[model samples]
Target: MTNLLRSIRTLPLLAFLIAIPALAAPTIIELSSEASRPAINDLVRATVSAEATGTTLGELSKQVNSLIAEALKTAKAFPRVKTQSGNTSTYPIYSKGGKIESWRIRSELSLESGDTAALSELLGKLQSSLGVSNLVLQPSPETRKKAENEAMLDAIAAFKARAKVIADAFGKPYRIKQLSVNTSGNVVQPLFRATAKAMMADAAPMPMEAGESQISATVSGQIELE
Candidate 1:
């Protein structure tokens, strides 16, 4: 009987132990760090487009193709320039009465170069047949990569410094629970735009300016205090 009574007493203790909840997780603080640097725009890009309209799709296609081919050949003569064909489309032109009057075909050629002088001269030459659709000045791939690497280093250092500051102020040691790094590339708009007729009228080389681009890097994560 005494043993049975002892067993009954132990049952309540086991129940109490099971009812207790697990320990709470430690607190975490998030920190964000960023770094940015200016990079010179070293690359120039120009887009030229050719369009033709005719009663027949075949004629329009032939004309547009010839123009693009000539442009491509001219671009190839300049060794420093890189050339590629862009978007091509064929659509029907409707008259005021809602009837199809002609077929319109359009093609684009893209040119990129680090040599501003050569590219500008080539653009001037092609203006007779092709119109400038868009122009942009930006950092080259190599330059952007270099800037991103430098920014990443700066961001990581900043993150570590901030974590140390927080830990010291709180009188505790910190460990990095998670970390992520991200990089951003800059976009630059063209400074000038010219029509085909205007470009053809002027025999002088096209003038251009390469501005500056900003590269940025960010580091964010949670730091656990111990």
Candidate 2:
């Protein structure tokens, strides 16, 4: 029992000794580097919605559904455009007396295409029966991936250059103790919107411009100087 007690007393000292070497190690410096490139937005996405209000929920739903269905069928005529159903929502409208006077139903249709002209023309057709809710132009997956990879390579090079400069400034040899890389991007959304009156006036092709997005990559790391 006396021997065991002595060993337990030494446990704290042993741990302190074990941590001494790590605490006395060389200085660790942290640095980060980034690179970015503009990628062309080759894809277009548009959201169109149909909404109806009626005293009967079933009637409102039917009206909204019929318009969405017609929009989908019309979208089929554009071979380059792909169509999909988006959100479907039903909510009750309240009157001044705080009572449910009518129900409103709304449904959305999402369209995407690489051919901007075809998509623009399709939007014009869709706007005749449905309201344009949102429109976005962005880089395609392949394009974004390529841009990110290129940026990552450049960022890595920049990080290494910075590390070398730091080591030289300190007059020490260094090794990477920890490293991490990340990539980010933002989607390009245009300011143009189609109004109900414009859509009803004539079946004219909507003007569209596919913008560019900046894709960036960052490399961060800690270096241990010896």
Candidate 3:
């Protein structure tokens, strides 16, 4: 009975002994930091839309469709793309006594995975064929997440560098204790937008400038102080 008591007492001590090293280790303190880089290391993407407007919806649709087909045929360097077909409505040109006089119809073609340089050249030729509807630069969801993670790691690295500086200043060199991460993206619009023009016979060819675009990733990280 006495030995059983002793064993029970000793078992608790053993447990504590095993846990001592883990408890005694210096705890790392966490510090958070953020870093932003403008227009660096980017994944380039482009959004191009073709629009045609006419007195009648059917006419607009037919004209735009014809232009799009020609663009596909004349595409010398641009990637072969499949544009999503969309329809848009325009208010009456002149409403007389609440009666519809004329209506406009527009179709949009949004495509992905086209070569940059070739796309620009194609655009130069295309604006005349199909009037540019809209354009934007951004990363897809998957690419965005990837860049965000990369940005976070970069921020963490920056944080580590700052932490080292602090430690050196204090005459106490340190190590990374703990870390967390975050990231963000912005939709930046272009300064200039292309004008509207339909490919009419003998009209001037488009002067397209599908210039190189930029994709940015932001990384933020928190490191624990040791």
lDDT order, best first, reads 2, 1, 3
Which lDDT values do the candidates have, in the order given? 0.87, 0.89, 0.55
Candidate 3 lDDT tens digits, 16-113: 99999988776354556676543332223344445554466777667767755666666534555334545544545666587767665555555444
Model 1 C-alpha lDDT per residue in residues 1-226, reported as the tens digit of each score = 9999999999999887776643435658999999988888889999989988789888888888998998888888899999988999888889999999888788988999999889989988898878888988889999999999999999999999999999999998989999999999776877666544454765456777788899999999999987
Once fitted onto the true fold, the runs of candidate 2 whose alpha carbons sit more than 4 angstroms away are 1-24, 193-200
Compose the digit string of candidate 2's lDDT tens values, residues 137-193. Answer: 999999999999999999999999999999999998999999999999999887866
> Each model's RMSD to truth, in Å?
3.4, 5.8, 7.2
Candidate 3, superposed: residue stretches over 4 Å from native: 1-30, 36-56, 80-82, 86-91, 94-96, 137-150, 161-179, 186-188, 198-226
Who wins the lDDT comparison?
Answer: 2
Give the count of colliding residue pairs in each prediction.
Answer: 0, 0, 9
**Positional deviation of residue 40's Cα in model 3 after best superposition, in angstroms:** 6.1
In candidate 3, how many Å is residue 12 off? Answer: 28
Candidate 1, poorest ten consecutive residues by summed lDDT:
194-203
